[model samples]
Target: MTAPAEPPRFVVMGPSGAGKSVVGAALAERLAERFPGLRFVDADDLHPASNVEKMRAGIALDDHDRMPWLALVGGELAAGADGRVVACSALKRSYRDAIRAACPDAVFVELVVPAGELGDRVVRRPGHFMPASLVASQLGALEPLDGDERGIRIENTGPVDGVVTRVIAALDAGW
Candidate 1:
């Protein structure tokens, strides 16, 4: 028999400079067309002022600063339509775990770029509090996806369509 369809709980995650937003938007469009019932939620808008303050000051946030925000994102995921894309910077395993604790079927897609590319994007891109300098701190905080049961890593190094195609291929591969 054909396998049971994959459960739908999609999260796009990675470092700030990794282009999660772009891919998530593309994914959202694709899913909305294909599944139509899918919903897309960008996690950036949910960031609390505290996170904003920390990032504004160029201070890397610790998990303590992330718990409430994580919970809020978690709630959003739990409450989402069965087919949905959650665009978030879920950098660490613990954080992703927190999300899964709320919705066990969640799938994480890590949008990644090389450090140099990340820096270039951050510097060239206009009007974002996450400075290029924070790349190091963010890299420091990122846990490799290898150890996680629910992670898929995709490089966000080229055009949006190309990256989205790669992501879609990865998703098709079932991580």
Candidate 2:
């Protein structure tokens, strides 16, 4: 008998207000249909209380503040038995590297959106600790996936289903 294909690991990444959580959840659901053990994890839930408070106060977290949290997030991804779809800002290259260190086969999917739209979306999102004001900080910190990165960049200006479709297609194409 043939061996079962390995479960896919994905990181749905983007700046604040780029719909990482929403898209990641949807992607996880779709993936679960094809890969029974796939699940979704929100990186925000892994943040230290202090980090949450800092972002809630509209303060941008420095690398020092993020390293520990990133480590925890990476550990979760690495520990997943089947497959995991995680949503995280992962704004800098080093941060992505941290995640890659944990799950080397993890594929990244970057959601690209215009700044104005991102700002609007952030302000409209309810009960989220990340303030709209911090959107600019996230944008400033964002480092687009490099040439060597195993990932695909999708524009999120369209409907959620469309974006999800594109992501799945890209993944199937070995992006």
Candidate 3:
């Protein structure tokens, strides 16, 4: 993990079924527990209406639809909330780039889960606009972390507590 010059923004990113939300939430809680002043933002809350509609109807979003969403999420990153963890399905490198453009200091934590497990997760989750079928497209768009970046790329194959603990350790190590 590369230590940031500052308490850089972080996006807990991956495909739809990669436990981004679950792990992001856990990480946020952990951060809050350790540093009461820390703030955590849920990036999904910034998605545009049309993009939500598209995903709700099982239609995959193109880069065009995602650009504005990226910008919005990035805007939040620019706020520079210390120990913040934003949950976003940052499926492409360009999408990651867009968010980074807004807050160049931020680092990414690539949450990873096997395809088969992801399918199971999508099936089990409820009330979310994202459809299980859309997982394939999201996976298709993913750019692997290449194990080269200075952040956690967790297996996301464990329980939420364990996952969160790993992230906390990674962050402590300044990933």
Candidate 4:
């Protein structure tokens, strides 16, 4: 008989300030409790120091600046022995494609939030390299998941627990 299918890797994706890191961590925690072999990572930690410095100065990253970082993120997910949930902006379709190229089974969880709320969230967040001014650029760069992509899009405006619950439900439903 065939071996059981491997658990899916999760990419918690969105524009900046959509709570990818928090939600991804929560989702990974719950999934690990059930799956027993799951890990969570924030993609920002994979960024190069130059990229961090650029964002800290309110500079938006171009594809040239992001490609290498995306490769590292994808490599980390692909190399893991257990399932992984990663928080990444993945702002463009091309960026997602790059990740998929390395980890073909990567499933995205696109977090949606209003631009105004995103701006406010970024402004209130301390110590993050990304500035509130870059929210617009991130929003502009965002490409919503395509109909054919393996993922779900959920609104993240409500309570964090509620959002995590919905995401877990969707993953269970194989959406």
What TM-score, over all chains together, does every model reach? 0.89, 0.95, 0.89, 0.96
Per-residue CA lDDT of model 4 for 78-103, tens digit only, reads: 87677899999998999999999889
User: Global lDDT of each model?
Assistant: 0.79, 0.89, 0.79, 0.90
What TM-score does candidate 3 get on C-alpha atoms? 0.89
Candidate that scores best on lDDT = 4
- Number of residue pairs clashing in candidate 4, backbone atoms closer than 3 angstroms, sequence gap of 3 or more or interchain: 0
**lDDT (C-alpha) at residue 36 in model 3:** 59
Task: State the local distance difference test value for candidate 2.
Answer: 0.89
The TM-score, computed over Cα atoms with residue i paired to residue i, of candidate 2 is: 0.95
- Per-residue lDDT tens digits for candidate 1, residues 80-151, read 444668898888888988888887878888887888788888888788878888888888889867654676
- In angstroms, the error of model 4 at 48 is 0.4
The alpha-carbon lDDT assigned to residue 72 of candidate 3 equals: 86
Q: Which stretches of candidate 1 lie over 4 Å from their true place?
A: 1-7
What lDDT score is found at residue 106 in candidate 4?
A: 90
- Which is superior by lDDT, 1 or 4? 4
Q: Write down the TM-score for model 1.
A: 0.89
Model 1 backbone overlap count: 0
Instruction: Look at candidate 4 and tell me the lDDT of residue 129.
Output: 93
